[model samples]
Target: MIRGMRGAITIEKDEPQIIWDETVKLVQAIVAENNVQPDDIASIIISTTPDITSAFPARSVRMLEGWEYVPVMCMHEMNVADALPLCVRVMIHVETTLSQRDITHVYLNDAVKLRPDLITKNV
Candidate 1:
């Protein structure tokens, strides 16, 4: 069976290292919370806001976790009015035995504001 975990986080700053660190931390939490293994991950699609084109967030994550074999792609989010800036989002598809409700989606730091209801639901 297949399951998915979605996570979003905002960079504390526009710097590459800050984005890298935060994304790494958020991905780690998703893996831990959902008990996701590297092999279980089928693919991960990451998107970042337009204001953040300094680097592809997925590259940092891949390097940080040594996910040389995992498939990851990065893209730019659609430009919309009054949208959040300096944000990175991820959708991870994984092979899992758990039910849909068993999966946990995470939104951390300033990103929590994007889905306050989701955070509350998970909590």
Candidate 2:
């Protein structure tokens, strides 16, 4: 079955290196928590808040040792007036046996605020 795993992370600044680092960290954490392999991933959709324009987060994932062929896309998150800033969010669609409720979602740093209720039970 195809399941979508969600994760997000907040960065202190919009520097390219920092975006790459945090994006990689967030993706890795989510993949590990859900026991997902590169081959299981069908696609990755990544989005950054409007304030972050330094780099494409998908580059970091594509550069992973075994992720060269993983389909990935990058874009800016919906620019809501009061939404969190400098945050990167990802949705990873993967082939998994786990049910939706069994899949763990990862939220790091300030991004944890995005899903407080879910985090308490799922993170």
Tell me the tens digit of each residue's lDDT in model 1 across 48-113.
Answer: 888987777887768955587889999999999989888999999999998887778899878888
lDDT of 2: 0.93
Span of 10 residues, lowest total lDDT, candidate 2: 114-123
**CA lDDT, every model vs. true structure:** 0.84, 0.93
Listed in order, each prediction's TM-score against the native is 0.91, 0.96
Evaluated at residue 107, the lDDT of candidate 2 is 91
Displacement of the residue 104 alpha carbon in candidate 1, Å: 0.7
Error of 2 at 45 (Å): 0.2
lDDT of 2 by residue, 25-121 (tens): 9999999998999999999999999999989999999999999999999999889998989999999999999999898999999988999866855
For candidate 2, what's the RMSD?
1.3
What TM-score quantifies how close candidate 2 is to the native fold? 0.96
